[model samples]
Target: MFQGMPLAGAQAGGGIVSLIVPLVLMVAIFYFLMIRPQNKKQKQRNAMLNQLKKGDKIVTIGGLHGTIAEITDDVVVLRVNDVTKLTFDRNAISSAVSRETAVE
Candidate 1:
């Protein structure tokens, strides 16, 4: 038996709580700093996907630029050139061209 030792139950419970508080704080920090922004971006991306329409000029994730010729539930037909049409997933479109691009 060790003399001058702290009570077993109290010491063990306090030590566990001390360890858990930092872990909980870390999870909260990660949620705010990392997870929250990622979810926001995903929501924006989903909104963009839902708003796809014909005649919308868009840039794909692959950097291809084209105007939407047709839109399906999950596929987009892009008219890249007079004879160069391409099909891509709705998610593959990164963003629509702004009004600045339409003027030119």
Candidate 2:
């Protein structure tokens, strides 16, 4: 009876360890596959937003396209046409279509 009890306890302990290893592996995979890529994309988006300047043609998240007419710390003015300019939060700009480069 004593030998049987020891064997059962050892088996239970090994079962718990086996379960723990797979659980840990799943968490690691989730972080690498999901969380890490999301964080990298967020950093790239922030860098793009910070580099925004006036005259850069941009597309908004809502699909509106225009040139940046004016910029402030938290606001952007988009010129859709000669008489149509719109104001939006800096974060509303999705991607810069083109950046105006200085002519040498």
Candidate 3:
């Protein structure tokens, strides 16, 4: 008849719910604050790579700047200068430098 049990402490089963609620909130906060933006950025980068074409000036992940001379399935030929053309993997190409940014 509830004579030997204490029902108003950490053993009453309410502590688990309180602990889990904060943990779930922290996870949601982390996903929104950190994971979401990174995923969006990656999607934008992938879209840029898929839309690449010849004469588009770009900079590689390794800091090499050039114009796209040719694009194959997995390779990109960059016209670094008049006489220098370098071959690199498609994934190595980083963000595309806007045409306006290169003119100034």
Candidate 4:
């Protein structure tokens, strides 16, 4: 009697593929929008950290600004003032201020 109608128990329209396509698209969008840019920024930050040298003025994650006096594999000694120096982790550095950039 209902030959033209879909059965309630039928497998239905687009099966597993339909459900998966949107999910894959969502993951792709998330990676492109969020993950990829974040990874790129992290790599740039790592390169900047690796290039750190003595006398480079840097800002720390805590917003403290100082010039690098000494650096080891994992430690950074900042000369905050003539008699004030502080030690921090290399990773604690947020950004470095180049001499040219500082002059501007």
| Residue ranges of candidate 1 with Cα displaced over 4 Å | 1-10, 102-104
- lDDT (tens digit, per residue) of candidate 2 on 57-95: 888999998888999999999999899999999999888
Please name the candidate that would achieve the greatest TM-score relative to the true structure.
1
Superposed by TM-score, candidate 4 places the C-alpha of residue 50 at a distance from the truth, in angstroms, of 0.1
> Residue 90 CA error for candidate 3 (Å)?
0.9
Candidate 4 per-residue lDDT, tens place, 1-104, comes to 97898775565555666788999999999999999999999999999999999989999999998999999999999999899999999999999997887642
The residue-by-residue lDDT of candidate 1 on 1-104, one tens digit each, is: 87678787868978999999999999999999999999999999898889878989999999999999999998999999889999998889989997576634
lDDT values for all models: 0.90, 0.88, 0.93, 0.92
Clashing pairs in 3: none
- Each candidate structure's TM-score, on Cα atoms with residue i matched to residue i, is 0.87, 0.82, 0.85, 0.85
Stretch of 10 with least lDDT, candidate 4: 8-17
- In model 4, the runs with Cα more than 4 Å from the true position are 1-9
The RMSD of every model to the true structure, in order and in angstroms, is 1.9, 4.4, 3.6, 2.9
Q: Which is the better candidate, 2 or 4, if ranked by lDDT? A: 4
How close to the true structure is residue 30 of candidate 1, measured as C-alpha lDDT?
Answer: 95
For model 1, name the residue pairs that clash: none
